[model samples]
Target: MADDFDVVVVGGGINGTGLARDLAGRGWRVLLAEREDLASHTSSASTKLVHGGLRYLETYEFSLVRKALQEREVLLRSAPHLIRPLRFVLPHAPHLRPAWMIRIGLFLYDHLARRELLPGSHGLRLAGGVYGAPLKPEFTRGFVYSDGWVDDARLVVLNALDAQARGAEVLTRCAVTQAQRGADDWQITLGNGRRLRSRALVNAAGPWAERFLRDHTQGANGRPLPARGLRLVKGSHIVVDQRFTHDHAYIFQNPDGRIIFAIPYQERFTLIGTTDVELPEHEEPPARAAIEAAEVDYLCEQASRYLARPVAPADVLWTYAGVRPLLDEGGSASSVTRDYLLEADAGSGEGGAPLLNVWGGKLTTYRKLAEDGATQLGELLGKAGQPWTAGTHLPGGDLGRHGVDMAAFTAELQARHAGRSPAVVARMAHAYGSATAGLLASPGREIAPGLFEAELQHLRDKEWACSAEDVLWRRSKLGLHYTPDERAAVAAWFDAR
Candidate 1:
């Protein structure tokens, strides 16, 4: 006999976890399967902003912008600890875009959706303020706008945690070897030799969506299944030592019409880049996308045009890349639609099990995508419950009742952990939020600087972290600060256990 489920979701990225969370909460017996650690790919390698794509306005993607803006407000309120309001400075470049056009665009961005949690956009004099200190003297004027920053990997993990709490079985490092569609259910075999039966299946495989359907799934008639065409675009980012002191992020417009962001990261670094290089169909998406040398030089050169101190490849402390599986719109990589499409195929007869394929989505819109995906599933599988995720929090997101005032909560945590390092306590507050109290309930040994054994155990037991890479890099980004011996020690701790 096989393990049975109402829904079986493939891929453990943001979309897969988000769908599982929503479907399971609505009373479905859901199982989410991931081939590797959660967010080991495209999901974790984002530029890490929850914003209405400001540049998308140039291509007249107003609807997408508006939808993202709406979700930005909702997501900010949902996870105050993990998501925080960020101010962005767009330095004026009259040659690239006239000031009037920019003003109009900012107006639409500000008013496109209901605004409450974040402030609106405004013009700024970048001649002598904190925001102007890092920019070249030529950039005397600019515009300031509001968006939100998120811990991308942690966000994915939190959604999975919530799904499990709602009784969904989340399996990591588990790949689906074969899936045979039955008239009313799907018979699936896993790499670990487990069998599962589900009434419905969702392919939320991100960049691998096309391949998953083509190679791993079989139709009821024993025929091959066709998948939606995808345009794979590789985006790369570089992290350098902090160049600016302020909390504000910078959005630089390049001569090629593409934009790059220089955001303050981890309190000590400036995160930049995202070159849109389209990958050929013949190329296979790798487990982790590697940043190209040309991409790094392009980012450094473009950013140097605005900053007083030029950025160089040698200055890059770390680099990452992600392949976006966008809908095939036959345009340039940067111009493709970030909006998603959910295509559901109910196998040939009445009461047939359905297969839903999720395609083309961005970080800001994952929640809405999941909601829409669930609505479609309900129409095919029968309604389980009315939408409940729109008003609910994701795990440790309950900082308060009315709004997410993260500062207030951080200060409260600091006061309680007076004996501990203020920085460590603050980091915990930001990463774990209200769960910080439970995280520090006992004084477990500090394995490395600011990383305690208790935190490692929590990650292993509750967050499904099996390796040092999951805990150090994806879960917390403490890898950047750890010494070689410290990192080895972490790996040893996992091995011993």
Candidate 2:
């Protein structure tokens, strides 16, 4: 806490954690300060896919799509425990989008970037195909394409964990209340009344990037960097009982020209989502990223468009929303670019400290974005950055380039543990990977039935979890399955801790 570091990062979301990890791996002493638990906001509330933006092709964003497609493969190799291949079924909707257009889009997605791990896209006859069981009989044909699904929040936490292993300090629930840029360094004051100094600063505060610049980063005696602003678009998701038996996900195109995904989640429920509604102005962060009444109905109607069974609001078991901070390109929320921008100000610090601001990035391309950000920062520091994250494996992901067999690995772990439930074994294999051994050694690892006390304690003691919300919601998606008493019990345990 007394040292002036190489870089002080001001967010703990994907972008910030990615940058911190990259920088620390490059031998930079880094300190990351987060206002709350990591992935507490937009990073956790994602659609949970690591594919190229297939819909961005319709908006003519080829570069972003190609970059994302390339990064998708890198991440799948880097963290295969939490990231795996997922096939998506897109039912042919003649009225919404022409078949030829869809064909062209799929072609680009397959060939945009060099593919190594995933198979190419192809058409499928849905009459007896595995993907048609949940859809109506009218949907006689569809298309299958390759993509990847991820535990988004866990990815961020893993990056932070890797950074810590590389000698970076991560401080959660510690906000940067103010930053005074000096001619050679910056003095930052945190919410908990601690202070630290850094030779450079990186503002990666997602939706609060602009606000942090306007308020916290003033008094530096230099002009504010001209920020390419952000448009806050809120996206929401609802969980329901499993609608389909197949492991594949569905990409349903709405009559309104937007598309949403219904993916298999946690082996018990179908995860349907994502409405792009403009966010309302507020002075403080919204208490909840709750899905609105109309948004719920809208998603249900969209699902019913293809499903044989009518999905109503009452069918929804849980809902979540996240505010996407897109580049303010003056378009409808759905059309905004998923690309990112890194703005580096060399002389903004009164003491010649560099300040870099990050804006507008999607989860799929976070690695590349962090690599580029590191390049810019390295140049400012008179050091050239060599890309290293692509080949390196994150923690618990040592199962080789393509990853381990989930079934075989879980079976072996269950055999070792003897008394662990199959559900707990499988979940641990996916969530903890090779790190499961250390976690299983903790007391009450299974705090409640099916829920591991060790997993919760591991999260709180090591992963910066502070409350039941942090454990159940972001660290793991167990909220939908936990009963009221079970939830209260978890909360009580957190309180005692």
TM-score list, all predictions: 0.98, 0.96
Best by lDDT: 1
User: Which pairs of residues clash in candidate 1, taking residues 3 or more apart in a chain or in different chains?
Assistant: none
lDDT by residue (289-367, candidate 1, tens digit) is 9999999999999999999999999999989899998999878889999999999769744335798999999999999
Query: What's the lDDT for all of these models?
Result: 0.92, 0.87
After superposing candidate 2, which stretches have Cα over 4 Å from the reference? Answer: 222-226, 280-287, 348-351, 400-402, 441-445
Give Cα distance to truth, residue 134, candidate 1, Å. 0.3
Encode model 2's per-residue lDDT on 269-305: one tens digit a residue.
9999899998754443364577899999999999999
lDDT of 1: 0.92
| TM-score, predicted candidate 1 vs. hidden true structure | 0.98
